[model samples]
Target: MTIQKIIRLLGRFFRPISLKWRLVWRLVVLQVILLTLMIFILLGGLTIAGVIPDNYEGRAIDVIRNTITKDGSGNLMLKQGPLLAELRKEVPNLWFIAKDEHGHELSEGTVPPEFKHITEALDYIGDARFVAEPGGSRTTATVQWAEDTAAGKVQIFTGAQGEFHIMALVSVTPELFLEIILPVGGVMAVATLLVIPLVVRSAFRGLRQAAVLAERIDIDERGVRLPVERIPSEIAPLVRAVNGALDRLDKGYERHKRFLIDAAHELRTPVAILNTRITSLPPTPERARLLQDTARLSTLTDQLLDIQRLGRQAQQFTRFDLVAVARGVVVDLAPMAFAAGYEMSFEPARGELFANGDRTAVERAITNLVQNAIEHGGNAGRITIAVNSPATIEVSDEGDGVPAAEREKIFEPFYRLRPRGHGAGLGLNLVHEIMQIHGGRIELAGSDRKGACFRLVFAQA
Candidate 1:
């Protein structure tokens, strides 16, 4: 497999394990491997430096030979001297048996019953020799030894019956285990337990700081960045990539805001010139119609600019009376409603209704809703502005109500229910943008009497 694929597979397998535990386990495995190498090195060094004797088998044979000899009657016998006692002290479970030339037992200690038949058949006499058999596979009986070789058997004995014979069986002692393996293993275990946790926690400290910094970043806080210094090298590239993406987004947003402002500025001069020329014409029906069309165009242009401004403007919030704003918008639009043969009225709340928001933006939004009601509330000729709570205002008209399917689309920018020339279709979209900037929302609700009710909900102060 490819290196990357193998790395990903390993990550998936180990992902469930906590970082701390993963580090601990790896350290422990390393310690075990190092300890094994140290043991091998120590043994090799001791042998090379002659600190540990390598001729243990030859020395043991010599000790056994010296401990056994023939009496005056030609029978084998064990010497009861300090030399034989010293050998027994050095090798735990040490025992010996001897036989004479006549095939008769002639020693103080007897062999285990299972080995009696085999010992009786031994018939050679020469230099001392040793034989080893794995415990379960022994030709005669079972014997236990040192912890590392609990089921092993060792025999150092003479063979054949024509002369003297001596047989010795022994198990290795615990002193070898204490001297060679324990000290090194104890040191390694202690180090792994004490040092790994602090090391793992220190390594992850940078990642935690990066997480806290990332959590606080948003569109408004685009300039903020996670610090790469002191971060682990393994994760530095990912953090850099995220910061790069944020930079691109901030640049694109600024460019869009600039284009909207420039376009609005460029259109104002031509629209004003058009209005002036229409007024200079002689008084006639055509001239009057041109004047009306120019006024509509001017209104549309203003709405377009409002849409652009509200799209980028951050809300400047203050505590203000929402009911007062709704009443003011109704008063301002009262002349237009009367000219369109409609009656307009504002139902003021019993008490002042206050909300936290930009007062000018809220006033513009209420104006748009009232204008939409005047245009679409077909000849039923009645519009009502109501303040239901500190954070809510509803404008309803007496006209053919909006269709269920078309209600949502009417709020989209430049989307109108009717064809061109009836309205510019930016009114509701501007209102929606204003509500969003103030951290509020707008919704179209069904009116029980007729027509549609558009509700503006703001955050309460």
Candidate 2:
């Protein structure tokens, strides 16, 4: 495949994995590559410098024997040669000194001031060698060894009876650091890098749980909280702040619900009294108009109360025939449709369509849809309530269809296409809320006929 297509395919394959895990894996892969490169560079440098021979110990002994000789005076000395001069030029930071069996300096070279006491330097180097090779004997001659010292790094070679001895001290210069210390440090750093992602993932486990809890929360889950313990200190403040905001919202929502309930209760008594008084009045057109207005006002107040009640209470879902409920609502409102000069019809689905929802709320939602159709269906036109399989109810009117722009806004509280006199505008909003509580939705659908269609979709029982 093409490069771009291959990349796209890879992206799709990895997309199901969470971002955190993807990032962690990427970091691990990068660290592995960097560590491999570092190790390669370190090995290449040591090989080029002749520090890591095929047999390091044997090569060291060979080099020492070749460089040192016993003079006629029985003193150890470095032989003069092009090889020695070349070695000195290549590693200028290094010092070579030969010492007798008594640890007296014999070779011609300046040791660092720190090692002016030859016996102490020997003791220090011997101690370092013992640590590196614990079972090796220090008194053995013809032995060659390398060790770190206070002055730098030293390689020592000795002959029997101190017939000849040689010390090669390599200073801790920048080049030496690159040759030894940098490689060792890089290996340690790579080990640390390999472990970091695991540590980070472990630390973020609690935060991930908090995120999941937050995702499940909505208006209904007002007092729910994310776990605080085990959460990292860096993220604890944000969780606390979110919980505090939820607390404030719950209190404010409770107050709004209380106001709606109280207002509805207070208005019910006056509206009842007004109805009674209106019935006793002399029959007249004006009296009839006032009664109609009062009835509309009472309906509006009841809808507001239903909105608050639904918000405060949880759904009591049970399996019930949705077609039956739709038929009943249509029957109840059929007379109202006739009175308003509209033809109301219920087209029931052929088979039983059971759904899981509160029956009362479902009936109420259907009632609102029918009433809305009657109000807006225009004089003497048909309003159809159709119940279909999987528990779907569609209510359509033979009036002017809702404009595309106004359909969404029509569901908002107190929103109307016309003026305030047409409706208090809580009917559709209450219907929407009830459907939402049922885990269903009410959608404005396109009607094949010349009218508006509203679909109420419900989950199958």
Candidate 3:
């Protein structure tokens, strides 16, 4: 092969997917290949054992039977002495034995050593083969019976001609190497090579997901979310964490943009009032009234800015003690509550009560709920604030209840249930936004002439 092609092949074989899975894939593939090779070797050994006969005494038995069988007159004789000698010359490694019907040895030559047992066994009965590696020559022997039918029931010591044959076994070593070991080893090597790549390729699929995510991501793109659903369960948590971080980043950017827009809008009222006062006649009552209006507008703008900042800070955390913050907010707003001719009451929690939230943001959220109660509450109306654990903040007012149709819509931004001249509609809407940002929620409870109750729920911390 060309040097370039060889280099490329080497690169493909050696390079791993990623640091973590690369080692894992290598280990898995190595185990599979090693197991396969071990099985192959075991099968090879069994096959060789089968091919090289464990016992070859049967061939020697056949030779004895063919030579010692009776003729027409039932006389047992060497079928041909010359032929027997030639056979002996041909199979140099064999051992032979001959015996008559009376159990007398007629002839014996080159008999395998273990066949001595066969000779002793023949004294009692029939023909048999025996495995005998005499003097460690590694051979087998066969012994067969011969009878003189013409001399029925022969007396003791009568000699009968008979023949015994032994055939030496051929060495099977060369064939075993070619037919078993070499071929099995080659097949095992090929199988191991093929399987390693497939295993490595399968494991690398997860790494490919991370790579694809990194490739597709763009800083400007808030619309795209990582596909945590498609990731493997083992990696799903990491994907979720990354998606969560991205979600926070997107929310932060949105908050920054909204802060700019809302600040401009809130500042416009005061700036416009100041502009009108400056353009009016000097030291007049109208100018004084305009300046006074400007101050109120400025205060409102400051509160709106504080609300925005507070909500932004709360957006990232899903944990805080809502009861504690609520208590603080109630005390802070006590003076305003008294001036509004509203009786405000709060039940202090006996134990730690928690909500998923930002403390400042949740405080502002409670402030809005109470303010809405005060503004809509009739003269001498009572407002109650209470905290119920595992998550609940209730604000109720003894004033006109919200209409059924307007209850849901009241939380929408800039959508006031009252007339167009009513105060900023963002009060409850901001509360809704705060709850959403903290991963909690706000809902309007049932109301009658007894008044409206709004409940804020914080999820388990």
Candidate 4:
């Protein structure tokens, strides 16, 4: 592979995928890298500790001894075979002299003249390696004692050196790999792999806790912050910065919520007084239009206050009777319904069907639905308010049922299917939020009355 491709492959192995797997793969790569250094250290340590002799030529001498046997003449001689042929190739100026204690002697290659007749003196030498002697062209020499079946108690002398041939040792000896490299390195790596996951899980437990805290942060959930305790020093800075940003955002949100509350509270008084003046005016078409506008203003202020209070009020929910809640909305808005030439009716449930919610928020939700029905109910058919079984308060109007295309956006804030210009469009969105806080929902239930239906379903207490 190209260098870039190989680097990318290595990077992919260590990239931030899963924390557990990333740590495992990186440590495994490290173990592999340390194996090479360990091999060098082990070989060097053994040599320093004198476990391996300075003049160790057992590898070369064993080759020579294995090649000795008798010819058909029953005299000791070195057999010419592939191993002997290979040894000749390794040591180009090869030579050996072998003789048993019984005095049968043999020699091979260009032996130094001084050592040519020295095989008879081999009775006392056990094993020895020597550098080139004086006036000698040979670089090294070694002597080994071996006992063979055909040639008994033979002492061999040869011209081979103690230099290590790594490839040759690996090719001839299996124990170097089978015993040392694999056993030591493999055991260390396996034990490391077994223990790493548990260590990683413990180290990252704090991060998981911070993630849990982050998930709980929402617009309605004020003052939530991710903790940095027990997090790694490298990652703790990021958590602290996130908590700071959340604090700034929470401050801005609180300011915005307070402004809306103050503005809506300020407008309520003027809107109520304007509605009173319009109701007191002479009966003119213009007076009717003025009253309608005044009522729309009052409805807008109520919805604004409802939105700000939703979070606080939802926490204070209690078991309240749905019959009482739904009947109250119809009674409160009966006069406005009559002024618009409409019949307002409340079909209470059989008994006091209880629901779990903030009663004021529930009352405001019913009020928004009633206002929505009056605005779009086409100024005909009765505006029906009913408390149904399983804790449902349904407000369905008698206008041209919301068009199939517009039904989806009807509940969206500031969305108007027809530009009748009576609402700021916060009514339905406020209702939807209030229902969400109560773990309830508003659904569209269409009917044959050629008008739209809105069903507010609450959890039965």
Local lDDT at 193 for model 3: 60
lDDT tens digits, residues 1-461, model 2?
89999999999987787656666667756765665566556655654444432233233334444666555765556677776665555444444444444443444344444344443456445422211222442222222333322222334633211111112222223554577556765675576566766787888899989999999788765677888897999889998999898888889989988988999999999998998899899999989988988898799889988888784244556788988888889888889899999987788776668888788888999999998888887766899999987679999988887887897698999887777555688889999999888888999986455888999998777
Predict model 4's lDDT versus the native: 0.78
Candidate with top lDDT is 4
Who wins the TM-score comparison? 4
TM-scores, one per candidate: 0.58, 0.65, 0.42, 0.74
Q: Global lDDT of each model?
A: 0.68, 0.70, 0.63, 0.78
Give the residue spans of candidate 3 off by over 4 A.
1-320, 349-351, 420-422
Between which residue pairs do clashes occur in model 3?
95-110, 318-356
Candidate 2 lDDT (Cα, 0 to 1)? 0.70
Question: Runs in model 4 with CA error above 4 Å?
Answer: 1-16, 54-56, 66-97, 100-102, 106-180, 183-193, 269-283, 313-315, 334-350, 446-450
Tell me which of candidates 1 and 4 scores higher on lDDT: 4
- For candidate 4, give the lDDT of residue 329: 81
Total backbone clashes of candidate 2, pairs 3 or more residues apart or in separate chains: 0
Q: Candidate 4, after superposition: displacement of residue 219 in Å?
A: 1.0
- List runs of model 1 lying over 4 Å from the truth: 1-231, 282-293, 308-316, 379-381, 400-402, 406-411, 419-422, 446-450
lDDT per residue as tens, model 4, 339-450: 8878887887667899888888889888989988988888888899988898888898777887777878978887876678788889889989988888889998854556
Model 1 TM-score on a 0 to 1 scale: 0.58
